[model samples]
Target: MKNLALFDLDHTLLPIDSDYEWGQFLVRIGAVDPVEFKRSNDAFFAQYQAGTLDPVEYLEFALGTLARFPRPQLDAMHAQFMREVIEPALLPQARKLLQDHLDAGDLVCIITATNRFVTAPIAKALGVEHLIAAVPEEDEHGNLTGKLLGSPTSGPGKVTHTHAWLEQIGTPLDGFGRSHFYSDSHNDIPLLSVVTHPVATNPNAALSAHATSLGWPLLQLFND
Candidate 1:
């Protein structure tokens, strides 16, 4: 009986990408060495913005970076980063919009390509009801194994997870007469195409072109 409001996290809800922010935070906190990992991170991010990066390859690269630190350290670093860096990056208007959806009793979800480890806390902080994100696997001893548990939630994979989440909650695709999806990347084309209302928020160049061609509404909350 409830409508769905699915949002892509990176560049959509927050002004910047969550994963990259986490990585940079790790560097600043000494969990990761910036001098050593900067090149890989920069290259990976460049490809990500261009929308040509392979999710699996990027995950492999990022997860491998986690091998340098223990789970306990990673956890502590994540908590610190969430408090200091991630939370501050959220736009005030974006938070208000999320609250408005919650006030209206809509089911809110974050459908992102970022892994669950890096995104779950942020989603919980925002009081999101559901999250569909790539998750890394862990070893029996509770250490990250540098492997993804399933398909990365990007492109077509996003559509699959969004539908699966809806089905799990018994919300038929057509049940929500006026469903909505907000994203900032063309990578979300598959998921955005299915929703009745598609909004492009702080869209990148490629997404802007696609949004223009489709006549979807565009919103830029921050000048930068």
Candidate 2:
């Protein structure tokens, strides 16, 4: 039987939150007003940390920037963002963790609440072929619609999306003899609870306590 390794992006593989950093990147590039965008961005990030984030509202705020610009411009900006922000945030330990899974012949994948547009490239950078993330809707003209194509892969929704992805690939979760999921937030509990091995990677206070209680392995990928 095959082994499966799933990873959460923000704070797990990377040191910073990709969605929040993406907003700051847009502000730095003057694509959005710093004061206004920062206020909303900080609030959304706070809610996410507290595990009270309203996915619809946050998606509207995050994806609205894509809706305002053409794909070419957004693509260029995302490329720069990846080079300047995301690349530097990639921790050596995180890469090693992914490599360990690969070496073990596990099917590795990234499951994140961040939209596909932002995370797809990040996944490619990490050499992960499979990604399960929030899907951003596009209009008939190939422009963002500032809406989600489906339910956001967050909190309990992560489990739902994972199941859907497995079914789409003609495999069920039970097919894996040993399934591992690494995450940093308590929001991933639903998926974590289902996995055979739930490792807490650089977990927050809440997640740390929860993982401790469950005797899950705690890993700190970024010390710098």
* Cα shift from native, residue 207, model 1 (Å): 1.4
Q: Which candidate is the best by lDDT?
A: 2
Candidate 2, residues 102-141, lDDT tens digits: the string is 9999999999999999999999999999999999998787
lDDT of each: 0.85, 0.92
Estimate the TM-score for candidate 2.
Answer: 0.97
Q: CA lDDT of 74 in candidate 2?
A: 88
Q: Which stretches of candidate 2 lie over 4 Å from their true place?
A: none
Model 1: lDDT to the true structure = 0.85
Residue 31 lDDT, candidate 1, scale 0-100:
68
How far in Å is the alpha carbon of 190 misplaced in model 2? 0.9
User: At residue 97, what lDDT does model 2 achieve?
Assistant: 91
